[model samples]
Target: MSQWFQYDRRIFKYFNYLLVIQIIPLLAISSYLINEINPLLFKKQMLYYGIGAIAFLVTTFIPWRKLIWWFAPLFYTMNLLLLLAVDLVGKTILGAQRWIEIPGTGLTMQPSEFVKVSVIMMLAYLISKKPPLEQGYGLVGFIKLSLVILIPFLLIAKEPDLGTALVLLITGYGILFVIGINWKIWLVLAVAVGLSAPVLFSHLHDYQKKRITDFLGQPSYPVHQALIAIGSGGVEGKDKDEATQTQLKFLPISSIDFIFAYLGERLGFHGMVTVIILYILLILHLFYIAIRN
Candidate 1:
């Protein structure tokens, strides 16, 4: 018991309190927004918050650095198998077949979400084993790294969860960009992507293609409504009675993807700026910590 207590104390001694402090304001604002929009969802969000806190605490107890080399590959393989299982027996939610339902619990888990963590761990493990040279990774190294990212990218994109898949793809490359990849390799990849754009577009689902078309041309239905919500708010914003776009359900999917529109309508330009600044600060802080460590 004394040894366990010492271990806990040692972990706490190096805990990053500043990171936790920065996250609190964001969580507080989200809770307030959810509470105002729907009291029931707010209650559920609180429960999720509790689960997240416990998860964070549990993760802190893990000896990550010590075990990462051996554990990462096993973890990554397990997640990949789970991703494959989704194709055979995944649950469909709102047109996307991206979740696996747990037996008898009426609960579904999204393997793509877990894939993000495993990918990062696998990347860390691989990179640590064969770090970049001063000129950065050569063709062989780059291909190995790209395969780590692209395998999962293809799987998730096959799920037609393009948004999440693209985010993962971008983030994976972004890490490579920071860690160092050969500049010639990047130029070649860019040219290759440009040449293949049409082929890629041809493979996308109709709705996904429509989204691209709408984005490049006119705004889509939900987007147009979101614009109205924002425009109606002006510079100062509107009262609860006046914010009819969200209040009267004109703003489509206001609780999820379009919550930013709801935020703009509720608090206008200044609020948007404030939230953006907070996000910038959080991102910059993270970058600083990553570079420092």
Candidate 2:
């Protein structure tokens, strides 16, 4: 019992309470906005928060430094296997086969989401084992790391989840960039991607291509409604019942993807600015923590 207390003290000694504080407001706002839209979803969101809190507490007790060497690779492989399983027996929703349904439960899980964290941990573990040199990683080292990212990118893209795949690809490469990469390799990559752009575009699903075209041409229906919601909010926003855009269901998925639109409608320009500022501060604080560590 005493040893446990000492371990807890040691963990708390370096805990970044400010980071938790920053996140609380965002979570609270999200819950409030979601509740306003759908009570059922709000309840599920709260349940998720509870589960996350439990996960956080459990992770606090883990000796990550000791276990990460093996655990990171194991976790990455498991997630990859799950991604592969999605192709075999995955559930489809909204035209994307990115979920695996749990047996005897009406709940589905997305391996792609878990893969994001695993990939980061795997990269960290690998990088710690073999760091870059003064001029950065050479061609051989670069290809090895690139494969770690590309394999998952291909799998997720095959699921037709291009957005998430691109995000993972960018994030993985961005981390490598920060760690250091040979300039020649980057130049070659740039040229290669440019040359492959046409082939990549051709391979995109029709809806995905249409989405790109819509972005370049004009705003889609949802985007248009989101804009209207923001514009209507003006400087001071409206009351809960008065935010007609979201209240009347004009803004699609107002509680989920378009929550920001609802926020704008409810709080107006000042509210939006405040949320943006908070997010900026949180991001800057994260960077500070990363650099310090």
Candidate 3:
């Protein structure tokens, strides 16, 4: 008990307070909205949040360097297997097969989220151990990292989660940058991405492409409704009951991806700004911790 208390004290003393601050607001807003919608769902979500928080806190005390080295390959392989399993027996939701149901628990495992974290850890470990940045670590390291990244990237894209795939790419590139990879390589990659944009656009699933097009002002039911919600907010929001009714009636994804929209309708522009500020601060805090460590 003494050792555990010491451990907690050391970790929390240096814990990212800004991140905690940001997360609290997000949780508060999400919980409030969820509770207003369905008390049972809010309770279930809180339970899940608690379990995740406990797991994270417990893992924090384990030396990150040791953990990263020991679990990198294991995590990478496990995510690969999970992705394969997802392909075989995953539950499909809203046209995406990205979750696997755990028998008896009634809980679904989203391997893609796990894949992101694992990929980040693995790359950070590998790159940290790479040859001097000035020496150009040869094609071998680049190839290995590319393969590691592509496996999950392709799998998640197959799950039809473009947002997640993009995030993986960004995280991989961010790790590479942190490891002092040359700017010229990044420049070339950026150019390649630009060059491939048209081909990528052509390959996107119709609805996937349509969502981007809709966001850019193409006529679509989802975009139309989202705009209405935003516009209706009008600097200040309607009452909670009215907001819930409006959201349930119009907003397609009032609970998930479009939760921001729901919040905007219910809490108005100031609320949206607060949420965005929290996200920004949280990201900055994580970056600070990553750099310091």
Q: Which candidate tops lDDT?
A: 2
Best-to-worst order by TM-score is 2, 1, 3
Q: Write the per-residue lDDT of candidate 2 for residues 1-293, one digit (tens) a residue.
A: 43332234567898889999999998888888889889888987777779888988877777666678789999999999999999999999878999999898566788999999999998988899999999999999898888889999999999989999999999999999999999999999899999999998998999999889989999999899999999999999999999999878899989878999999998899989989999999999999988988
Question: What does the lDDT read for residue 221 in candidate 1?
Answer: 87
Candidate 3 has which clashing residue pairs, if any?
Answer: none
Which digits, one per residue and each the tens of the lDDT, describe model 1 over residues 84-129? 9999999998888999987985556799999998888899899999
The RMSD (Cα, Å) of candidate 2 is 2.4
TM match of model 2 to true structure: 0.92
Weakest 10 consecutive residues of candidate 2 by summed lDDT: 1-10
The lDDT values for all models are: 0.87, 0.90, 0.79
User: Which 10 consecutive residues of model 3 have the lowest summed lDDT?
Assistant: 1-10
Off by over 4 Å in 3: 1-9, 38-40, 60-64, 244-248, 283-293
Instruction: For model 2, name the residue pairs that clash.
Output: none
Expressed as tens digits, the lDDT of each residue in 149-249 for candidate 3 is 88899999998888999899888866666666556666787899899999999999999888888778776986677777877776887787777435467
